[model samples]
Target: TETLTNRDNHNYDDVMDFYLMDNGPNVTGYVNKGFDVHLDDFYNNLTADKKSSFFLTALHESQHTMGLQHPFESGFDEWVHNSKIDSTGSSIMSYNERDFNGNNDLRIYDLAVLHYRYGVNPNARSGDDTYGFKNFEQNNADGGVYIWDGAGVDTFDASNEKDGNGVYVNLTAGSRIYRGGNTIPNWTNKHLGLQEINGS
Candidate 1:
């Protein structure tokens, strides 16, 4: 921990977890500082959005490690990117408020950007091939019902009801699941069970 904070020519090349004293009130953390991977100190102050904010910042910084830049920021070939969602710009990369749906996630548009830039990465530690992204209901006015996970495009007919009234059984290819219904029992693969889906 002490070694990451003290950055220099010798240790700047290593992964770092830093504590920033000057980030904005809304800003929680950063992945890389001066090209060194770092996580900021802003995570400690996440009051209502603690869990969401933590993962959001971690993912944001990880994108940096993957050579991804904010859509609003400049990109390769010295091109400027205008990728902020006009409706609700609260993705992990943006300064807007981080959302807390089933999971605080990157915007659908941002995931597309990553796919466009680096292509799909299969065999994740969890979830789909697209960086462990899974289908969770997004509760925003933007009508963003999906998380644009690293996997290819997948859509389903479902509802956001906690009672499991609108759950979709059909999924597209590359959509790794963690849950399922009673009939579709596959524990190692599916994280959600059917009884839970029915709200029993």
Candidate 2:
């Protein structure tokens, strides 16, 4: 995976997006965390009672990496907003973020795909992983993602890639993180990066 550059970015065949803490390639979108909208902003973007942006972003991008493009991105732009309000079509691959409804989860079909990819068959429905200060994220058909910080701190780094203490925790796709009794830190996708328009 090559590092992402402001002048060298395209959705196809791109695998990674790395940045510095400065005015570098700041990011906001999933699959690519910029200096401006990195991971911590994932949580910061949510409402008080509905703060699941981080987890959802993680899952969203994970789904993308798993070959599940946004419903519209699947060469089906006609389904973008065919109905009134937002209709995600009830698939995690849908862009209907408003449907997050605090329980934004991977649909059954998606889980089926992931299970097959991971060599594990899923049941009808594995239980729901609710969002709260716990910072729980879905791992696989079994366990979950865990992020632990000493000093009783419960926070992520400004970039949401590391712990507040500057330690890198393993956050892989198809997993979730939980901060039990810890200051879930703030991450930043807070930098400014220019977008590359077609034929620019």
Task: Name the candidate that leads on lDDT.
Answer: 1
- Provide the TM-score for each candidate, comma-separated: 0.38, 0.36
lDDT of each residue in 115-189, candidate 1, tens digit only = 434444544223523222244435542124333344444444333435543233434432423333435422221
**Alpha carbon deviation, residue 20, candidate 2 (Å):** 10
Tell me how many residue pairs clash in candidate 2. 24
Local distance difference test values of all predictions, in order? 0.42, 0.39
- For residue 150, what is the lDDT in candidate 2? 19
lDDT of 2 by residue, 34-139 (tens): 2222344434446865555445666666666544555444234444564311233244555565543455566533543444334332333233322222232332
**For residue 51, what is the lDDT in candidate 2?**
53
